[model samples]
Target: MKKKNKKLEVRKPNQEVRLASNVYIILIISFYSMIGIMTLCSLMLLIGIIAFKTNNLPLFSQIKTVISTIMIIIVLMFLILYPIKNTIEPETKLEKDAFIFALNRLGLKSKCELEKLNGIIHNLKRDRLHFSSESDLYRIYLLLENGQMVDYLISLRDLKQLIKIGQKVKIRNSNLKLPISGWCSDHLSISVIDEEGKTFYKFESYEPFNNKTKLKGRKIVG
Candidate 1:
């Protein structure tokens, strides 16, 4: 009886662990299911509203109430998921090395020298969608060699920065055109001109590259 009781007690913890894992799995499934349902409902409701207005259907007030409720639920979901959204995963050492090699091959050797800045890239997030032209949308978090963390927002195109340099060179009044193809390179060199059209600072950083495959598959490294 004693041995049997001990065996049962041992099994109890295993059962509890299994139960907890099952509950967590269920929670994840339910959360995603709710998101899908909510999204579908919202899309359907939007279509209904358009149809009602287009065909002059009645019961518009009822539709408005349903739309408003869905909007609130979506807002609440966004708030709940906001913490994890846009969170970037860090690259492994091997991947980072491969990325540095790629950048070096692209002739951005100076910028790849993170040690000079006493910083190591902790995480990097690239813009999957071409959303903004004015802002540095791509984000890179750096862990300083001194143990401090900082982030750098780098631009996709050098057009704006190059134009600013042009302004300083008294070329602001002159219509200057740069090849659209040359405007964006993720790892390329840029030569800035001074007031006398002399080459000023020429270095490399995350600018823009026209390689769609390279840009889209940035996260995958061998």
Candidate 2:
């Protein structure tokens, strides 16, 4: 009897539910920023009133200068601290629940269908020599509507099973034309047609995108 081959399992990447935590974080930052602005304005008004009433006395002048300096420092601190706060705060259960609710509202299932795209693979390149990481080893290049070609990154492990260069393909739930779009990398299914018939190849961890895709551009639907 012949021995059977075992399939390899790719570990799912740990991606944050950014929309959930971002909403709370933005609200917190905005609230504190507004408060700081109001307080600074009040201090400035007090200084102005004192200067006007006292006819800009020597002592009042010095006090006003010190207060102005303090106000500038506070504004600088606000700029620095808010960004740190955004990163340090952990996502709570409420945020996670809200994210789930949002997904449900949008009618998107986990690794489910969203849209279908059709395009020809303009080019494909594999640069194993210069890249420092395995993920950067392979890329499927596609020509955009504006006559510019963009390289979409893919894992080197899935390079063999993916669509070939110059092949006309109908891709589901992926938009290569957009600068950034949602791609379900974990569950990839590609169909190839030839003179013989149609053949389907299902793969795991095969999308041509990384986590930075979400941060660089707009992909609100995913």
lDDT (Cα, tens digit) per residue for candidate 2, span 1-222:
111222222233133544563554444445557668767876786676566755656886767766776677678667765664544332333333333333443443433234444455687667554435445355556554345565544443543544566665434333122101122232233333333444433222333334322111111221
Question: What lDDT does model 1 reach?
Answer: 0.38
Q: Candidate 1 on 1-222: residue-level lDDT in tens?
A: 001111111122344444443433344345556678768877886677566654554567666766776688689778754443212111222222333333333333222111123333465466546555444455445565457765444443433333231122101011111111111122333333455655444333332333221211111112
Candidate 1 lowest-lDDT run of ten: 1-10
Itemize residue pairs with steric clashes in candidate 1. Answer: 184-208, 184-209, 185-208, 185-209, 186-208, 186-209
TM-score of each: 0.26, 0.39
Candidate 2 regions with alpha-carbon error over 4 angstroms: 1-78, 85-117, 128-136, 156-162, 169-222
C-alpha lDDT values of all predictions: 0.38, 0.44
Best by lDDT: 2
Best-performing candidate as measured by TM-score = 2
